[model samples]
Target: MRETLLLLSGFVLLSSSTNLDVLLHQSVPYSPQSASTEQAWIASLESTHTETKAQTTSTVEGERVHGSMTREMKRQYEIAAYRRTKAQARSTPTATPSPRVATLNPIFDKQDIEPEHRVIADQAFRIIPGHCQAFLKNFYVRYDNPQHRGLGGKSTIILTGSVPDEEFRALFFHELGHLTDLGCFQGTAVAGSTPYMDKDEQIWKDDPSVSFYQISWMNSQAHNRGTTEEDFVSGYASWDMFEDFAESFVYYVLHREVFARRAAENDALAAKYQWFQEHLPDLPKVAKSNTRWDGAIPWDITKLSYDWKPPTELVARR
Candidate 1:
């Protein structure tokens, strides 16, 4: 039995097919909504809605104070004034919750992770049935060749007895990407249907010079000496959209420094800067103002990684 090195929590360990043991424990909670509080919330919502309508009427009437303005022009003026006033009112501003950074939980080495991560993990799990807090299965994915320990099949994820919280979360997200591909977590891509599986091989072939064997402009020792760019990069990229998706998510949420670096080099990253300007929730007004684009993603058309950008709309969302 070959012991493959795996990372769990932040600790590294060696394990093999025969010795790997996965504990099955999910930390899902059933925090049902309270009815009395819900009713109060509904009442509050109704009051706010009523006030909004009343304010709209008052603003419209106030605009009529100037008869010469056309209806559209008057509406624009009111909107602009309302926004200016609102902006001023919010001058002192409010602190926003930071984007949750996925951290390595040391307790996983001791098998003591709290339910907080499990809760977030479920969001990705909710995309797939028969998948819960974390899942494991020994099956091959298109990105990977068949291995003694892998993920595939109808149910359960395989764990090697020692899954650290952060690594576990990474693997959970990694597998979740596969689940996402299955239309389980994110899409309705029928198994073996989407054409994305071969995207990297196609891209690396198109640009063997830059991608094939470059050292991590970020890391000095990433590339092996004398490794041909075509072989190294082509193999490194490995039609693995799973890794791409995971890398993209990690860069977006945690390694934003890398995101910034990529955006500078690749036009696709620039497009993502613009795209994220429009989509990322909870950004400060200042950062929102910094994006130079409005309608399209800022990255270059060819180099933009799909994981870095949101999917283009295929059908009108009705």
Candidate 2:
């Protein structure tokens, strides 16, 4: 995602070019033009949230609220969000796309996917077509239940279902990496907080069986060229310690042989790989052909953004 920093109404808005910027621009206190827009957006969100609570809650006498109305309202909210996102995209100059027409890969719709390819997607992700768009322009997966937000056990991965099978599967594995951390394989903390920061290559420095020379040398070259932000696996991994572990986990799980070769050539990666091998002992090794996780998915999440409102047909709302 491309992040742009903006100074607006005495507030620093750090937003992804699409959803974040659209939703955030309205909240600037100094803009009268946006205040009304922001209020309407907030109202939509509140209304949906309120309805969700009403439908799910019971009175002291144990009577349920208006369930049908709640369902209807939810649908309205989804349509509203979809419309708002489109409106914002048209108005926001920065969001205009290049001349290239990116083909949207549909993950659902039985008529759309080939019979052979559609075999296990719904079984794996429990995707509900029409409830949500095939692709979320801004994010890969959204874990929405209070307990499941971000990476949590209670969370179900809400996929955009917009990419090709291989790309979608790669995203699935990446989220799986987040789930791994949520399960306790948290790799490292921020650099200043732990010795692991500078010791990625030397986590087992004193262990005679480990060799650090090759990875350390590689790290030095990377530092000189600014190719990697840290001694983690990839540039994206350098964003945060958690992401670092996730990136590494996906690589090791999917492309074991290739990752192993790379690990052997770099001590830091080897130690990280060793950590996963020990930490997630039961993690199955996948065939190289199955390792489709290569780069970040091309996210054009204009459809995923909302001026305000909860999705009406939310697949896993809580």
User: lDDT (CA) for every model shown?
Assistant: 0.31, 0.37
After superposing candidate 2, which stretches have Cα over 4 Å from the reference? 1-156, 184-230, 289-318
**Worst window of 10 by summed lDDT in candidate 1:** 30-39
* Model 2, span 1-318: residue lDDT tens: 112223244222333342222111110011111110011112343344443453454332233334444555656655766787898889988856543333223432234233433332332232222212222222222112121112211122223244445544544555545444432222232322322322123223332111222332333223323333335555555444435554665566545665676667665677877876765565544325322324332121111111212133221221
Tens digit of lDDT per residue, candidate 1, span 1-318?
A: 012123243222233222224211111111111101101112343344443332243344344443355567667767878887887888967777444434332212122223544443433333233432243332111112112222321132333213434444444444443333222232223322322222222212222112211222211223344433222111222223333333333334433444565567555444444443443333222101122322333221112222222112211110
User: What would the TM-score be for candidate 1 when compared with the true structure?
Assistant: 0.28
Best of the candidates, TM-score: 2
- Predicted structure with the largest lDDT when compared to the true one: 2
* Deviation (Å) of 191 in candidate 1: 17
Models 1 onward score TM values of: 0.28, 0.36
